[model samples]
Target: MTAHYKNIVVHLPNWLGDTMLALPFLHGLRSVFPDARITAAGRLWVSDILHHFPPLDAVASISSTSGLINYLRGEKFDLGFLLPNSFRTALAFKLGRVPERAGYALDMRGILLTHPLKLTDAIMRESMVEYYMRLLEPFADISEIPRIMKLYPDEADRAEARRVFLENGWDGSSKLVGVNPFAFQWDTKRWLPERFAEVADRLAERYGVRCVFSSVEKDRPLMEKIKGMCRRPIIDLVGKVPLKILPAFMEHLSLFITNDSGLMHVAAAADIPIVAVFGSTDWQRTAPWSQKATLIRRQQDHEPCMKPTCSRDFRCMNDISVDEVFNAAEKYL
Candidate 1:
């Protein structure tokens, strides 16, 4: 029998990409408890991006453990879900006095959860979308989980995206290709700036499409480096576009070429055709969960390094040629 949950609180994932991947789980939760008031608690940025998402009734910006506990206590949540596999998060839920808690039994937090699901090696090998969907098994049929990830962009978001495009002189006559040259977590995951520049220029020359570059504030220097290397003029929107408006902005893109990064998932959710470059990270686990997406990674005799940082001179990324990436993008264009 399905448990009765009136006021449910879910601790969302910390990373933007993982948070996007959790859409299916959220969908499943809402399906099983249609009338429940579901609140998503996570970092401030996560709350900001998911503010307009329909599945969530409210978004709580969790700053510290004590603050999260206080907020959860004040809300009197009947049930809680921990998307992040951290002992601290489970402790917060327990101390917050949530009656029922469900999550994977990883990090030795099994005792804290009322429904502690096992985390298996097979589940670990599955795509992140599937991995997150597994969390719904106790409450609903896993097969019912939504395969397609989506983001709801409001009218203001669309207007902001339009304003950025117009200010950047995009006339909407030609196709716009987005190139993201930097990865947030790992330098090993990034393709060379020169290669990215070459691919951007080649795509422009071949398809008559304008290349638009994007990244966060900290990665602006890398975007600048790529822009300097490119022979063609590119629209650089690094640090200018807000996270909330990214999905709307990506909807205008014909194609997105990027590393296995947060924006790659955003583009995938936006339904943009993508060519994602993969390196040290496990591509199978985190590949864009979109049919329109194409992944490019070098074949290796050994397993992927799977490290945050690489010491092997980033051979996996370096081996993937600009021609290969351009050809992948060409198929979409």
Candidate 2:
């Protein structure tokens, strides 16, 4: 018998890319329980990004485990899905007295869950989209998990995007290419900024397109460095655009060149053509889940180092040349 849920609360992942990859799982949950009220609970940025998203009825920003437990108790949710693998989140759900809790058995939290699935090696090898989809197997058919990832950008977001374009002197007809040079905190994942500048310049020279760069406030200096290296002027939107407005802003882009970072997944959600560079991370597991994306990763003789920071001169990223990335971008142009 298929169990029916009335009030469901899902604890979303912390990282942006992981949250985006979980969209297919959210869709499956909605399909199985069309009448149920689904709530998404996560960090503030996660809540902001998911605000007004179709699958969720409410978005809660959690500050602490104790606070989350208190909120969960007040909601009296019948079912809770723990998407994050942290033991702390699982404990919160268990203590909050949710009637049912479902999640993978990793992080030693299996004892806390009402429904715990084992984390097999094969599932570990699967892509992140498929990894999240596994959580729906006991409730829904797993053979055909939805592959399409979507985001809703409101009118305000569109307006902000338009304002930035106009301020940057975009003619509205010329193609705009987005270049993202920084990868969150992972130094090993980022390719050379000078190479990025070269690719941006070449793409503009060849296609007569305009290159626009964006990142968080902390990465502004690096974005400026790349902009300075480019012979042709590039529009720098770093620190000016918010996470909620990125999807709307990305819609104006013809092509996105980025490292294996959150913006790479954002570009995928925007359904834009992408040239994603990967190093130190397994491309098979975290590559952009878009048919329009072309991945450029040097085939390392050894396994992926999978380190947050590299000491060996970052050969994995350095091995990929500027010409390689530009050629990949050409396919989409």
Candidate 3:
């Protein structure tokens, strides 16, 4: 690689928090090769989140397996980081003829790697970034783990968010707390809508804060259900808000109460105080990385079932009551 190494590719994770988790490693990559042009590729839903990441010299879109192959084939990248642990990611770089590629030797992708490092023993016990940083240790010794984070929002984005609040009749004079009850795109992962409504009602009554519900287009009905449960005048801004508006709106939030969803991850990245309610997910493994986040996990072991439908009823999340989350909200309120 020359002084101004032009092309570099990074594969980002699918989930929002995991995508942010890769920021430190992304920063490290930039530190090692300062002038290298960095391009990140991932799912379309992640575009909302990664669009705010400045480390990326540019962002690339890969819709299909062929698209990934074609994009990598087109760009003669000097180096690539396969942050997404998959055989296909490693193979894409190999087929694209990238000279230097570094990633964890996962899913037999080691066969395609120019440099593949083993996962650290502590990685299984620690956060996701530790797993990613381990890949870079062989290239250069990372003595102290860097506290890397990202929140890049344009002025237009902020203006749009303000417009959204105005459209919803929010004057921005009173305290506004966001509620995100829809989790991953799975029925079992969601906490009961009635329970969220109950909690929203309590927050409004106690804190004198208005509740603004947030969710993807598919989750509009879920937010409506919360609005139904609210005794105070609640403003429902679920499906109408655009992705670009999210970061700035989240910045203005007094606090965000949510389930294990992408929106929750976004709030944490924006350095907004968060009261995260955990159900089936493991707080230790996927807890909010921000200093201001307060993770409220039910004291139940063996809960993180990565499956969409659990054989057993979701006792872990179901056991978490409206009262528990309301109690945790007291500190942030």
Candidate 4:
């Protein structure tokens, strides 16, 4: 027999980084409704970290017009929480004929959402995760929501990481440092590759820490840039390590330094000290996670960059010198 209120839809954010940041909210939702079925609806490519999470009952990867909408409608969710502010996400529930729908009132999507929360003056905030949490724990007190971001890597994942490292001649004794140089989404988010390389080299030579670089297949060219700039050698695992190994690799690292990207957030969730180089994005709004993280940003110019593209000649990131990054990394050292 079909269950009653047995299915629910959770529309996730498009970005990988934001999804991990919403851990607290996700947990809150799960806590509130243990009986109701929870189905996370979003793209599959962005679910590298989320899939590892045990709390989520299921994730629906829907992107195409026919398949995406059809799958969402077919789920038969009793209620739906549209985390994404896009009209399409809200519209899906309406089309699905779901009994209840709730979301933030944005992009003229208020009418689509049955439970549209009223918006006050747009006050600035810190971090994308916090923004997500606020939207999640609405109606009740916002401050009560705990800002917790954590990742649980199982024995198999850790074992796999160890096996990969062992086959490649790693004994788990070497201090692991993660370096991410590519910011695919925005140019302004990318600090100079040479600058990042310099700091990575310093960390390796001065502290005897092993450097590990993370990048996408296309961003492999940036790895070359970092390799050329650094005096000390680094392990370039851009296309080498499989996706499953990413979490364990990140967990193995003592520190992670990168631009505003998903890998940075993963490192933070793994509880590894992270140093994020911020330019166009606001450090306050999207800094790593907590005080344990060191955020290097240029507040002097382009304070809170809501722009997806840069118009300031990369002034925001350019102002952040190699010295600043190295100094921040040194704190964790």
Candidate 5:
């Protein structure tokens, strides 16, 4: 059977935030290849967020590299977009015999890609969304891009969100404010939980909004500590909501206040107003891509670097007070 450039595979970014940032690229790809069948392959947790993504005909979780390549060999994908810079990703496409593959020439994988793009240092400094969007330039004519991150939670997802809201006894009259206190995988990016507690307290007491704390199962201990510190009522949804259902859950929120974590991007994709607190991470590179977002970050002595752990006195995050976040939240609440 000869391939007709109909089956296309996109190797999605692994991180949740990066995955969310890739939506615009996927949208552009769909526009460019309207008749082509697009399959997004990634970890189950990462691609689960795109359960309602319209551009994708299917979402397949890649559990093993060899398994993926073997599967692709049979399917005969004509073109591939290797979004992840890992050499393994390019190798998979190369071995799978995807005739046309395009990606950044990083991780020494340029030889594997048929269309390897060399991004300049200046281009690397742009927002992750823009960086991802640039990848589609070779495949499509992208004139204008939408800044607002978008997610499509179906009617069933919306119904589930409403059910959870009712079960939590959330009053429809009162605005819902989401507080995510943990920043996964980076210690320097996390602001003090006490600060988040204070901000959640103020949102409830002063703004008259119902505050909900959202976090993954691993961050439960931190969530508990923040919950203990708070004086006002806070509904704990930690570890309960699945990633696929999170967009629906976020739909109930009027505003989301969070550390520069994956959920921050999720909130933005859900189109809820966000107050994202940045610490050591450069807001320019990874801030929530939403016009309604208010970024609260203290100025650093030096330009932000990609150091996961802070070498300096963690003043960048420590200096961002509860008042600043509360003030930002006031705009939406």
Candidate 6:
């Protein structure tokens, strides 16, 4: 039997990719408590990601534990779903006096939770989307897990994307391919920039699709390196747009080729086909959650180590040839 809860506050994960993966869990929670008002709360940037999600009545941005507790106290939440396994998260809900706090029993915070779910190695080994959805099991029946995750980008976002496209000389008629070569904060996950350039040049020439390279402003140097290596014309829009417009811009693309990064998940949320390259990290745990996606990982003896940097020759990423990635992109185009 499902317990009756009138109001619920779900604390979201910190990272963009993980937050996107939690869409299924959020949807399932809504299904169980249809009448309940759900508030999705997290860091400012992460909370912004949930802005367009309909199930959430509001999105609260938290700067610190004390601020979060005060915010929760004012909201008078009946239930708290702490998606992040931080001890601080559990403590805030407890201090806020939320009647029931539900989360994984990790970080020695089990005693703080009204309902704590035990997490084992087997569960940790599962895909991240599945792992996040497991948190919903203790409270809701959750008979079916959603395979395709959902995100809602409003008309304004689409309009901004269109404005940027026209300003950049992109005609609405041409098939566009997006190349994302830079991974945020993880150098090990990045494939060779020259290789990415080579593949983009080949795909653009063969298919006649307008190839566009995108990255945050901080990654402009890397994007420039890739652009310098390219033989054919590739639009360099690195650092020009904001995160809110990314999904809508991604919607314009026929396909997205990228490393295992936050943008990969964003592109997946936009329902675009992807050719995601994998290296130090395991695609099984953090691959794009899209049926239209194709993953390119080298089959090495020791790979998917889940490391941020490689100590060895970095064969896992280097071994993957440009031809392999080009072939994958060709299939989608």
Model 2 ranges with Cα > 4 A deviation: 1-3
Task: For model 4, give the 10-residue run with minimal summed lDDT.
Answer: 118-127
lDDT of 1 by residue, 1-333 (tens): 554678999999999999988887888888888989999999987767888989889998989999999999999999899999999999999999998999999999999999899998899899988888887777888885567588989999999898998799688677899998888878878888899999999988888899999888898777767778989989988888888898899988999999999999999889889999998889889999899999999877554888777766677877899889888889998
Please give the lDDT score at residue 115 for candidate 4.
Answer: 76
For model 3, the superposed segments whose C-alpha errors exceed 4 Å read 1-6
Q: Candidate 4 overall Cα lDDT vs. reference?
A: 0.75
lDDT of 3 at 166: 79
| Candidate 6 lDDT score at position 174 | 81
> Residue 198 in candidate 4 has what lDDT?
88
Worst 10 residues of 3 by lDDT: 297-306
lDDT of 2 by residue, 1-333 (tens): 344688999999998889988887888888777889999999987677887688889999999899999999999999999999989989999899998899999888999998898999898889999998888777878786566688888888888898988887787788899999889898888999999999999998999999999888999788767777999978888888888888899898999999999889988999999999999999989998898999988877664888888877777888899989999999998
Local error of candidate 5 at 58, Å? Answer: 0.9
**10 residues in a row with least lDDT, candidate 2:** 139-148
Clash counts for the predictions, in order: 0, 0, 0, 1, 0, 0
Off by over 4 Å in 6: 1-3
True-vs-predicted CA distance for residue 1, candidate 2, Å: 4.6
- How high a TM-score does candidate 6 get? 0.96
Q: TM-scores of all models?
A: 0.97, 0.97, 0.92, 0.90, 0.95, 0.96
lDDT of each: 0.88, 0.88, 0.77, 0.75, 0.85, 0.86
| C-alpha lDDT (0 to 100) for residue 35 of candidate 6 | 86
Candidate 6: residue 165 lDDT (0-100): 78
Task: Write model 4 residue lDDT over 104-172, tens digit each, in one string.
Answer: 889899988877865544534545665666655543465765677777777888888777665664556
**What's the C-alpha lDDT at position 309 in model 6?**
75
